[model samples]
Target: MNLKNTMLKITTVVAVVISFIACEDDFATVGSSVIGEPGFNASLYDDAMISAHSYDLPAVQTNNLPLNLLGVYRDEVFGTQEASILSNLLLTSENPSFGTEPVVDSVVLAIPYFSREVLEDDEVVYALDSIYGSSPFKLSVYESNYFLNTFDPETNFEQAQRYYSNLEPQIMSNINPDVLYETESFEPSAEERTEYIVDGSGVTDTVTMAPALRLKLNNNFFQNKILDKAGTASLLNQSNFKNYFRGLYLKADEVSNGGTMMLLNLLHSDAGITIYYKTKVVDATDLDDDDDFEELIEVRRSYTLKFGGVRVNTFEQEVPQFEGENLFLKGGEGSMAVIELFSGPDANNDGISDELEFLRDNDWLINEANLEFFVNRDYTTGTNLNEAERLYLYDLNNNSILADYILENVGQPNSTSSAANRLHLQPLTRDENGNGVKYRIRVTNHIDELLNRDSTNVKLGLVVTQNVNLISTYRVLPSANPEVQRVPGGALLTPEGTVLYGPNAEDEDKRLKLKIYYTEPKN
Candidate 1:
């Protein structure tokens, strides 16, 4: 008889028949898990747990049971899973105070201090919503070149048979003498995969995490922009990927402490290196809109890094690095010199400062020929191209002046293309990652606390005249007792635990979940 999960109601599960030959001495100690049968309090996460069981049905009609038996068995298995799932599941609900008035920038304080709780909810929702699944492409992420390749129909179907053999009666018999089963594996054809590809589910917010990603992005911070992960440094230096910025939808109704992270793509062409900022759409309507879903990129901003050729393109070469704790712009070619931006009140400043200050303050902006006989630091009296008296402008010897690379042409290329693939819950495929990348702004309780402070301030700009090191400096004052926690209805997985899941195929954009609620200007 067919048994639906709803029909099972509160009926206890029937025990399966035994098949294993057992001896009294063979009654191996039934590994006691100390579960359900005892008084121990057990905390089970129904959705996150994976379970599997095997047992023989002593009441089988015959070894050669009718095909219908297979269908019945599958249904029974499904219902059992459903019951277990429903035990701890929470249904979705709307808050009573959800006014269309639009929360905007006006936020409220969260009681009991929790940001991780909020982040957990966001992750759980994302997993349930089908976020971050398998890649559309079958390749690993390519920092340079990457592509997705699947089999042709003939080849795909040819390989599919290998799965069917596992479904045969003989195979099922091996599993259990009374075994009668059905197979449930239907993959899309190549044409179907390419044509009817619907992927890119937004990240869910029904999960919980610990060590709460205080910097994790939220639902509406920076309009869900993804940052370019890497930028090429001039002169063969390994590009720094994580140092860039990433904007995210922040979750913060009330201020506390939390944050988000994002990836970036830094490209290096022979002429120069270009940085692009990218984002994805997470509109509430998109959820209800079940149209041809594809992860699309929303372009943000781009910057070109200006660094002298790796080997001192000019008379002098300077490479930037950190020493004795503080970072300094070192490694110049022709001359060994030091450049300092701020001197008097520059305790927190770097070595390279503004170009304007050198000319006006230190009188070092003149051309090299004029520095009294153009003597190199090596004491080499050289015949400079300038006059016997005039100085060479843009000198590299000044320890206080920073040289600026004036951008002549900032070309905004029209290299637009749609991201066609779904990131379902399988191994994360590399197709979702594109050469084009960006830095998105992300927010959480951390910023709210920042906005609350009187001396709270931050700046976004290049460190020197030359566009290098996109600095996002937050002039933060340390707190003795930092109050950072998860959001309400959210849990901090122990030891930085995560309750995240993705479909074998789902939304391609890997989600960095935010917890605070937000709405667009028009609602």
Candidate 2:
């Protein structure tokens, strides 16, 4: 058989395959117009075959299991987001060392704040990535007097061991003063400490360190809660201690308009509460003096307590756009936006959308399929918080992720032939103005499957890229290994929100579109 004969036979097989793949609908009559007659030039096929449209969908639920506190952030465009944290504290040692005649000196709470980046080169560089705004905001710490049970007593199972973001705080208000400490004139700033390395001769090199929020907590609170429970059963075991003293709730007070929010690293080793106390010890130098064998010395020691058990960060967001024609997209379970792609008027009346119906019958092979999203800079740019750099698009039905995310995770190629096997999400890009402008995602395989294969056209979700997965290596797919899925949600610990041009937008180009570039095979 010659090359032309072989090509003719291949096209015949493909046509038979399409018959088996495409549903029996009115689109069958237009089959010849789909792929065109034999002996077609590939170069003639360009954007002529490509058809694009968009539709606005409802918002979906966000899995807001954050690792750190998001604090209180108020944006003119996105509105207000006030976050509070609830955590169970853990002791450093089994039986803490509070020596003889332990006297409480002072109790301090240290929370390490994180900037987006750290400068390596010298000369006072300000890499203000995290912690937007500098205005003053109040923070209050309270004791969670009530017991936060791990599991339900009725059913002794781990399945019931869960705390939601909406759980009410069981504070110690019954006591005279429930407030542990409250600071109104508090300022959170990065501390640059100069450290010198003294090896053999003298000072060698100097290093600078980031600063933390060091608040002097009420000494009486620790003196009663920790120092008092020295050798008791409460201090001996962690569970007992948690039951005896529930935990702490850090609440952020809202400022009028221009106040800033800090991104706290709660899991950092330096972020914790330290109780300073003095213990009596034997004086070794005074041993020579028979009368002065033991001396009352102000021996300062500290026991650090950190968040070990379940820590839940809650968010209260207000997006005014939801009231109008706009679609609101925010991170954390507080708020999220969904997308219904390739849906609207089925112009061809073939039981499928005009674009899908057109592509269904067309014999052209898709080269590239790009889904572009424009930013709503009209409102978002005016706000203090900038637009989110990246957005994660996933299957709305499963809440697990699209084939694109999975294929990207496994390092597989996404092409028209592999359309049955892969769907690749788009990487984030910035405009020349150094701001997030548009997001162009590639979903060639996804579109190919929808057009030629028997696959469900499930709605897709758009959310902050950070909310998808903290550990980049881990993938949220059942097809993925057990270890990858076990990583769990890292939580949305930052107070950030973004507004995007939805399909319902009045502007045509700004609206989301599924653009395809295709070419007809040589006959």
Q: Which candidate achieves the best lDDT against the true structure?
A: 2
For every model shown, the clashing-pair count is 90, 8
Worst 10 residues of 2 by lDDT: 54-63
lDDT of each: 0.16, 0.56
lDDT of 2 at 350: 62
TM-score of each: 0.14, 0.73
Error of 1 at 329 (Å): 10
Instruction: List model 2 lDDT by residue over 226-335, tens digit each.
Output: 88778899888888888877777777767666556666667787778877666665654563455775675445566788866766565555645355435455544334
Q: Write the per-residue lDDT of candidate 1 for residues 1-523, one digit (tens) a residue.
A: 3222221122221120011113321111111133223333222111111111111111111111010000000011111000000000011111111112222221111101111222354452111110111112111100111110122256864532111101222222222222111112211111100011112342322322221111111223212211211222211232211122100011111011111111111111211222222334434454545653553433233223321211100010112221221111111011111111112222235432222122123211110000001111111112111101101112122211112111111121211131211110011111242211111111212222222222122211111111112111111112342221101000000001011111111322322211111111111
Candidate 2 overall lDDT versus native: 0.56
lDDT of 1 at 511: 21
Clashing pairs in 2: 34-361, 34-362, 35-363, 65-491, 66-491, 191-211, 404-423, 404-424
